[model samples]
Target: MKTVVITGGAGFLGSHLCDLFIKKGHRVICLDNFLTGKKSNVAALERDRHFVLVEQDVSRPFRVAGSVHLILHFASPASPVDYYRYPLETMRVGSMGTHHALELARAKKAVFLMASTSEIYGDPLVHPQTEEYWGNVNPIGPRSVYDETKRFSEALTMAYRRAYLLDTKIVRIFNTYGPRMRIDDGRAIPNFIAQALKNKPLTIYGNGMQTRSFCYVSDLVEGIYRLSRSRYHDPVNLGNPREMTLKELIVFIRTMTNSKSKIVYKPLPKDDPKQRQPDISRARVLLKWQPRVAVEEGLPTTIAWFRDRI
Candidate 1:
């Protein structure tokens, strides 16, 4: 069986990935500092002999024992609230943490995968962002901590692939929501869901006309798994192409939860993307993948999970 090392393995996306690898009959070594990641996310896996959870800050150099077939660098503060609170830590993980992860992959001769985000296409000038888009990001904005660091990580990954001939792949993930997302994640999906569940006002920034494409976490992880197994060395967009607005999202959530949460308008956050969508043509042709779960199919499951937690 293949041995996989996943940094940030206790976080939302990382924990899901850890479960996927284990279910596929692989040995998984999960490393996380729990800075923003909670131990409870992976608590269920503690009993499995094949799953190893290590408390580690990957921004600092670390070593792993034995052979590793794949290294998935997913360690970083993902949400705006988390990054704004821990900017230095976020930058360190994307820079130094990524460097360490790449070095480990090089030493182990393992295929490396960097978990990138569509935020690299900040306030995207392109309607449906493709890998070719250079993006329109503010280098010194509040969101720069998360956006630029990911851009840097992608560059570093490509450098390793070019200079050291490392087998590396990058996936530019779009908006993804599913179980295990923190209640105060500070993202649209989690924020709206939490508010609606509590019968509180659902706040919308700006006019709520800003658009985003949501991909179910299961579909996103499935695409990621396919990319990890492939030989592609460039960034591929992996998200649903279907687009929706924040207002519409709130309406749907309110209906699903049968709540009376009123819509409240707020000023838009600076540098927030006006439109967000993915051009997944590359993923379709290369990975032979497309999101199977529609918003209708995915949202109910997510809402139900939140209901239980609340």
Candidate 2:
């Protein structure tokens, strides 16, 4: 069996990936510092003999004990709220953390996969963001900490691939929601679901016209796995292509939870993308992957998960 090392393996996305790799009978070494990640997300895997948890900050220089067949660098504060609060830390993880992860991959001759985000396409000028779009991000904005760091990480990953001939891949993840998301992570999905469940006002920023495409965690994880095994060295967008407005999502959540919460309007955060959607043509042709979960199906599942937590 292969031995895989996943940085940030205790966070929402990382934990799910750890489970995926372990289920396939591979030995998994999970690394995290708990800066934004929680140990509970990965608590279930602690009992497994093949699963190993290493409390580490990827931004710092560190080492894994043995040979690693794959290195998935997913260590970073993901949400806007988290990144804004920990700007310097976020930048360090993306830049230095990615450097260390690449170094490890190089030493082990392992396939390195970097988890990027669609936020790189900030305030996207294009309707449906394709892999070719260079993106329209403000370098000094509040959101730049997360956006530019990911951009830097992608460039760094590509540099290693070109200079050292490392086996490397990058996947640009879009909005993903699932069971383990923190209640206060401050993403719209969790915010909306929590408010609906508690019968609190569902807040909407900027008239709620801003759009986003949601992909279930399972589908995103599947796409990541496929891209890791593929020969493609460039970045691939992995997210559901179906788009919906924020207001529409709130309405759906309210109805699903059977809540009486009223809609409340608030100013949109600066640099929030007016429109966001992924053009997955490359993923389909290269990885033979497309998201199978529809919002209609995915939303209810998420609501149910949050219901229990709330």
Candidate 3:
């Protein structure tokens, strides 16, 4: 079995990757500092003999005991609230933490997969963002900490592939929601769900006309797994192509929860993309993958999980 090291393995997406790898009969070494990740996310795996949890700040250099077959660098604060709260830390993880992960991959001769986000296509001038899009990010804007760092990480990953001949893969993830997402994730799905469950006002920014494409977490991880095993060295967009507006999302959640929550309007955050969607044509051709779960099929399960937690 391959020994896979996952940085930020206790966070929302990372924890799910941990579960996927272990289920596929691989040894998993999970490293996290619990800054934005919670230990409870992976608590269920603590007793497994093949699962190893290491409390580590990956922005600092670290070493693993054995040979690693793959390293997935997913150690960064993803949400606006978390990044705005810890901007410098977010930058460090994207830069220094990514450097350390790449160094470890070089040492072990392991395939490296960098988890990137669609935010790289900030305020995207392109309607359905493709990997070819250079993006329209405001470098000095409030969201630069997350966007630019990810852009830097992508550049660094490509550099390693060119210079060191490292087998590196990058996946540009779009909006994903599922179980284990923090209720206060500061993203649209969880925020609306949490508010609906509590009978609170569902807040919508920017007249709720801006659009986003949501991919269920299970479908996203499956595509990621496929990419990890493939020979593709460039960034592949992994998200559902189905697009919806924020107002529609709010109404759906409210109806699903059978809540009396009213809609509240708020000013859109600066530099927030007016439209967000991915052109997954590359993923379809290269990975033979496309998202299977629809919002209609996935949201109920997510809402049910939140109901139990609340």
How well is each residue in 73-123 modelled by candidate 3, as lDDT tens digits? Answer: 999999999999999999999999999999999999999999999999999
Cα lDDT, all candidates: 0.95, 0.94, 0.95
- Could you tell me which residue pairs clash in candidate 2? none
Q: Tens digit of lDDT per residue, candidate 2, span 254-286?
A: 999999999999998899999999999999999
lDDT of 1 by residue, 228-278 (tens): 999889899999999999888999999999999999999999999999999
Model 2, residue 112: distance off in Å is: 0.3
Candidate 3 TM-score versus the reference: 0.99
RMSD of 3: 0.6
Can you give the lDDT of residue 197 in candidate 3?
96
- Which stretches in model 2 have alpha-carbon errors above 4 Å? none
> Candidate 2: global Cα-lDDT?
0.94
lDDT of 2 at 211: 90
Per-prediction TM-score: 0.99, 0.99, 0.99
Residue 245 in model 3: lDDT: 95
lDDT of model 1, residue 190 = 90
